[model samples]
Target: MTETGDLSTAGAQNGHSCCAPATSRAEAVDSHVSHPGADPAVNSESEPEFSFDFVTAGGTFDMGDPFGDGHPADGEGPRHRVNLTEFEIATTSVTNDDFARFVADTGFVTTAERLGTSAVFAMLLETNPGAEAHILGQAPGVPWWVEVSGANWAAPEGPGSTIDNRRDHPVVHISWDDAQAYCAWSGTRLPSEAEWELAARGGLKGRRYPWGNRLLTDGEWNCNIWQGEFPRTNTLDDGFIGTAPARHFAPNGLGLFNTVGNVWEWCADWFTRDYYQHSPQSDPQGPDIGDKRIMRGGSFLCHDSYCNRYRVAARSSNTPDSSASNIGFRAVRKAH
Candidate 1:
């Protein structure tokens, strides 16, 4: 959606990209809900929008880690710096109630409900492969991923899944389109990758996690990242197993919550692992055209043994139309 590319050359607008080509996870997957009674149809013209409170981050901030950890993905490399002008961003992610308000007014259907099923990390699936299966499959990760039947955002595990117990929790199973629709309906927008990292830092540098370099300073959980042993069990030391409220953990230096873990927050730009190779010193939003969109802030599923993408700089991508019960979004009121 970035419409500010260089226009020097005669055909630069549509010219071949000078940056490395981005992988193709940009395709939007449809998770339309056709259930008996759910949300109404949502399109570009929905109205009665919503509003959010945001914080403006100005000046430069260190965007990457000072020390390397396990399983640093390819895109995290060439650690760089960025100097952003003032921009206000929501302090918390979009909540279920917030999205509910959008649905109540505009009748928006999330991508998960639309798909009937979505790609869920296999580790989250209770199925042990010997259980009943329907198009069940796994993606290559530590615990592996499963495309379980009926695993949409509502029922994270499938037909039996639901968001009923989780109200204060952030709404998962949203696709890029779903998030964009909610943002539009609410009069907000998704944060650019840089803006997100800046807000997440809360004005801290060289810190491993959002609150600080330490996961726990005074024998307490600062963020809603994974807890207990990986894959097998969770102690819920952070007062949550799957997910907590958007404000469950302590806010970072900038007063943002869950910037490290909870659910992957969608960004405005398309995914590009190597885009940082040529990242501009000022607000680099990423490549113009690509398949997959960028997702940051790992989820409750993140563990050091497997997917520890919860780090401040760690990144991953998913198809625009693909929605996961572990995926949700936050919005940024435009800075004027």
Candidate 2:
């Protein structure tokens, strides 16, 4: 695996190879597109209410990579014990339907919407006719990521794409700031990196996946992920080429769905590679400050040959304002 002195900084500078493209706000603004008005059907006052099924999680568990398979630069090592107080995490990532309600209620414009473009996987553009017209350019070094105008949460692939049929899928093209806005509207908060891992483990201990160390359970795929050669062909072995329905897979032991796949969920804490070395034994809240926020759980694009960050302990990060097709988030709250 290629190692950068600072993983998040490298991602911001040249985009992640196997995950979301990291386009800075200024980069996106240079190729701005007119912000289309919100869809009346989704932004109307009569939109349905949004709710989340949260599972209670807490207690002491080992955090970090037990298998030592993580990239050293990503800081998934020095496995250590951590104690966490009770907290509740959503069973699945926040979906388009959920985010639409937040937008409808508050009329908040996402960072992507304001910047006027978002990064999309170039492979998706191949299947979408006329999408190439919206392409601003490829992310530097990573040609697979196509920066597209009008590619916000509402129009995931570009101007003509819509989330109308993907209401159940996790809302992609979401920046950390976008998630924070949603959390504020919902009276919830993003999970800390520690809290996120604890909940993702689902009452398990030192396992590669939430279900166990094995990638497949009982000869069946347990999660959605890249099934074939990297950046080329996908066999659709897990039945999805992109983001799957947020709640599609079997729930983990603690009843969390798609904990390590589907989309990379943003965490509340800022990222630092060596934070684990100095992390507190209880309730580690990450570094005091940093340029990027932590992102956990690999997305549908993750493949073992390239980016195998789907492991429970694996972590990555991007700039707070960066938005991409493979990134999304879930909310957390104190357990009463």
Candidate 3:
């Protein structure tokens, strides 16, 4: 993942791979479309009201890579124990309607909307080829991501797209600063990387996923993730291709929904690949200074063929001002 001064780049940057069965890819192309909008069966019901449904968590748990299968360059290894103070985290990510309310009350403008542009997936831009002419550029290495004018939180897929029926979906194209602004207005803050890991684990120990060792439970999908080819086709086997509702599936043991998938959630920490080497054992925040902010929980675009960072211990980062179609965040508060 290339890090530059540009603000229109896709915030999510990681390196990995995982592929579905070869047979699944061929069938996926025909059955799946470029976008995953509101599925009536998945989101016709309204989202749970944003009541700061916070889950209080505290104590020590193993943090970082446990399997040693993660990329060495990204620095996911030498798993260690991290102790944390009690804190309350929102049970779900901030939804579009939740952000709209914040904007209505504070008149705050997101970086994307202010810049009048943001990075959109190539698939979505396919429907409107003319948008390519308005392109600011492309994300380095990931050319499928095009930076287009007028692509913001309101018009996530660029022009002619709307969140009219996606009020329950997590708001995307939100930069780290935008998320921080919302947290400030709500009297909360984003969770530290350690705190986020603790809450995501849901009291489980050394589990690859939030629910446990298994990716699926009793033939039931636990999160919204890409089910077919990476970037090329999403089979939508989990019932979603893009962002899903904040409460699309059952919550973890701690009652946190979509903690490991749906969208990459921003965390409160300056990212450093080697920070874990000297991190504090007690309530460890991240590095004191860095070029990028940390982002966790892989998005619906994640696939095994490439970018399998959806695991509980995996992570990625982006410049604080960068925003994209598959990035969002949640808020937290220290318990008194």
Root-mean-square deviation (CA) per prediction: 9.8, 7.0, 10.6
Cα lDDT computed for each candidate against the true fold: 0.64, 0.80, 0.74
- Give model 1's TM-score versus the native structure: 0.78
Collision pairs in model 2: none
Please give me the total number of clashing residue pairs in predicted model 3: 4
Task: Flag regions of model 3 displaced more than 4 Å.
Answer: 1-52, 126-133
lDDT of 1: 0.64
Tens-place lDDT per residue, model 3, 24-91, is 00111121211111111212123324644887988999999888756665677668999988888899
TM per candidate comes to: 0.78, 0.89, 0.84
lDDT of candidate 2 over 1-336, digit per residue (tens): 111111122553322544776555543222121111111123334524555598899899999998878887789879999998888889999999999988877888988888777888888776566778988777556677877878889999988888988999999999888887777667568888888999899888878999998898788998888888878898998988888998898898999999998899999887888999989998887887677778999998888876888988998988788888899998887687
Better of 1 and 3 by TM-score: 3
- Candidate 3 colliding pairs: 17-304, 18-304, 18-305, 19-305
Model number with the top TM-score: 2
Cand. 3 TM to true fold:
0.84
